[model samples]
Target: MTGSVTLVEVGPRDGLQACKHPIATAARIGLIERLRKAGVKRMEVGSFVSPKHVPRMADTGEVMDAVGSRAEPGDMVLIANARGLEQVIAHGARTIAVFTAASDAFAQKNIGCTIAASLERFAPLVETARAAGVAVRGYISTITDCPYSGEVAPEAVVPVARSLMEMGCGEISLGETLGRATPCRIAAVIEAVAAHVPIEALAAHFHDTYGMGVANVWEAVRLGVRTVDAAVGGLGGCPFAPGATGNVASEDIVYLLHGQGIETGIDLDGLLDAAAYCGDTMGIAPVSRVFKARRG
Candidate 1:
């Protein structure tokens, strides 16, 4: 854990998407700018999906338009289909992420399609992204446990990761959507998928519902995962997955990594400021341990 790790902030998109109240577009932009100022080089600022389905993301195009020029190469918008991809491209997105799940039931519940059908859908999207010179990042949710299907076999994730990589995704983020995964389960899934896909191309996305998010991240990094997805102030949850909680906080990740002699290149103080801003704006205190411990 001594080397550098890439932390992709997801607060603006995934974090705010699950909020009960609507987050203003300006507030989202403010959060992204604060994260960038705190040295967050990679993040998911928005997504291109139907506003009716995800009203929180209705202003995705506007968010991208405001920040696209200043966004980093790794900054991206989530796209569910060809239409979403087309919209993101028009907004001048340099990178985009597509998501599916290892469990068919979870995939159907989350994206309204089967696992196979999801891949079939992403194939052309990946191809189009390649032609458009936009980098693609693929996400596989419920890698450890699925709310609809229960525990998922690690082997089930291999083909999905391979398909995403084969379809030209530069990185594959394995998501522990339920937040019930321990290091053992995390290792099992990562080991299974890493055997088929390069470990370097894998990223870890975890939730803190059962309080294992940081521990799971530790296991993933120990197993050679460099890219990690987190949200500032521990903001995020699966809308489709019942009882799930927010993502592992970016503040917690920085604290853990910096303590381990690992470099994340994020300023802890600045990150706290950003987290405070988010919590204040939303009228909720940050749930991150570091934020509570330091700011309290």
Candidate 2:
């Protein structure tokens, strides 16, 4: 708990992707710059996917160009297939992330494929990324509860995480996409996945829909997860998962970790400024407790 944790800010990508109104590309760039200025070394800048499917991320190339050297070593873009990988590589992305899921139902809904099929599709992509000297990270969603399929088993996540690890992913993030899982379930899934994948190579991504985001994160940290995915202002939810809410706010995570005498290498006040900028751009108030409390 005392050691430094790496918080991968997902605000620019995951946070703004599901917005009802189109977020201007300039606003996205501003958010990313503000986050970097706040000492967020690792972040999900954007994704390389079809504009038709995810129009918000269509300007990823432009964002990358504008960010230029400001993008830190661990900054990453999500890639869904070979095409996405090619585009991100062309954009000079140093790191890329691929995603699958523990639930076949959610996979079919989100990516139009089964769990095994998705892995097969990513095989060549991962190999190609490795050869190109780009770090690869993998994500497994619906670690405990699936919107399409209810009550996923912890064991269901093991093989998916292990497969990503065996395929050369430096890190695998386990996602509680539904935001309904409590600390007990979070511990269960992490423990199960850690058995097959190295504990050091796992990250936690949680939603705050049910107000369990911070508590779930505390559980993951207790279980030895050092990397966490969060968004500024708690922006973003799973478009495919009905009723799902935004991710755990970055400000809240920094407060929790710092309060516990843990290091996150993030400045809370700077992060709040970034969050406020994000909220203003989107015309919505930040829902993070710490942000609201501090502003008051």
Candidate 3:
């Protein structure tokens, strides 16, 4: 494992998008500022998707403005086509994310396309972003298990990751989107992908649905993944996957990393404070183990 880990906070976008309550725009920006205070240099501040499809992220542009100068502007929103890319660039974004799934069933369900078609769709957007001088990150969902399709093969994920890498994506984040991945399964997926992609070129996005988020994180680290993605206070879920939970919490991941003497450059106490602020204002009990322990 590398000596340091880069934790990309996704609370402002992924964490808040599925929320039933309308998190105020100021509150959302406040989360971004607070995470910055906790030493988060990169975050997915918001998305530029259609409001009709994702009402919660309708104010992503505003959140970006509010986060102005507090942190470097990065991308986490799903860009389906050129229109989405244009909106992201118009919002002053220099980085963007395009996602594809390893499972055909989930791909079709989520984006109305087969895995091949989805990658084809992202091809133009990826080319456009690269030409426009923007950095592009690739995301692969269902790296382990898909809610719709049982056990996704590691072979199924390798080519998609390779395609993203060949398409000029600087980084590819592998998603155990349902968060049900065990250490063995997580290791298997990483092991396969690492064979095709460099360890430095890969990251992991593990969910907490089965309460195995941190364990899988540790396994990823052991397998030499230098980057991890988390949401502040564990505030995200897949709308399509019923009963699945949030992203692994930022505070919790920091606590574990600090305990293991891993350097994340994050202030754990400050991150806890931010988690508290999110929980209190959002009216949801933080799903983070460390945050709950610290609060209690």
Candidate 4:
């Protein structure tokens, strides 16, 4: 496949994190293995955060330790600070992701820090990780709209993405936390960020709360985003964003990309199988459009 899009499957970490129940280590390991079979080279197995805040991810270290060797290059775990970074490194994550927000209100709600403080918090960790030959990916939420602050300007989105790149983050994933964006809104944010960061180095992570997630994703790809952050079976919602939903499903993204002759190197059948696994495991029906259609 030429001109392939890098689909970062976040089902294991970002997908399952906000759920109520804790996942068994075996189930986490099984999902990782199956996702690999679906040709996902870069995936997030879990996050290294406090179990009190994110109980589902409490076993992230154990999950990583079990599947680290099977992960391809650029596999990631979310790290909040130096402490979380240590956990990620300890469990063998060669690449890690850190987060911030375009809106300070959203930042405070999500991470309990202002935008500047959150960046400050991650500064040392990024430096230490880079010196250790590890790569960092940055995630910025509220690109176009914030749950607390409401509308977020494209101008506000630019500096956050740029700062992450300047701080040694190789790529930055722009997040639509509320999933309320239209294609036009997505374009504005992408355009503003592209002025500072290379378009190819930008990615989008959209929630599907309003059913616009897939549309916004397609618009982003058309606007020159080569990478996208998605979860298998559409399995995520930020607790901070009230009534928020999951990312545009990995199964749906792969289906769209391949249909447009943009290779994602994923097997739709394998992805759907993972979707089924998540549905059974979470005790909720799969939410992705493709998953529903296939099941029907």
Prediction 3 global C-alpha lDDT: 0.84
Per-candidate TM equals 0.98, 0.98, 0.96, 0.97
- Every candidate's lDDT: 0.91, 0.91, 0.84, 0.87
Q: In candidate 2, what are the lDDT values of residues 157-191, reduced to their tens digit?
A: 99998888899899998999999999999999998
Q: Whole-model lDDT, candidate 4?
A: 0.87
Q: What does candidate 3's lDDT look like per residue over 1-296, in tens digits? A: 23889998887777887888788888888878888888987788877776877788888777776677323655455567888888777777778888778899889887789988978888888888889877888889889888887899999999999999888888899999888778999999899999999999898898999899999999899888989999988989977666678999998888888888889999988888888888777776778889878885
The C-alpha stretches of model 1 lying farther than 4 A from their native spots are: 69-71
lDDT of 4 by residue, 130-219 (tens): 998789999999898887778999999888887899889998999998899899999998998999999988988988889998888899
Show pairs that collide, candidate 3: none
Q: Model 3, stretches more than 4 Å misplaced? A: 69-76
Task: Tell me which residue pairs clash in candidate 2.
Answer: none
By the lDDT metric, which is better: model 3 or model 4? 4
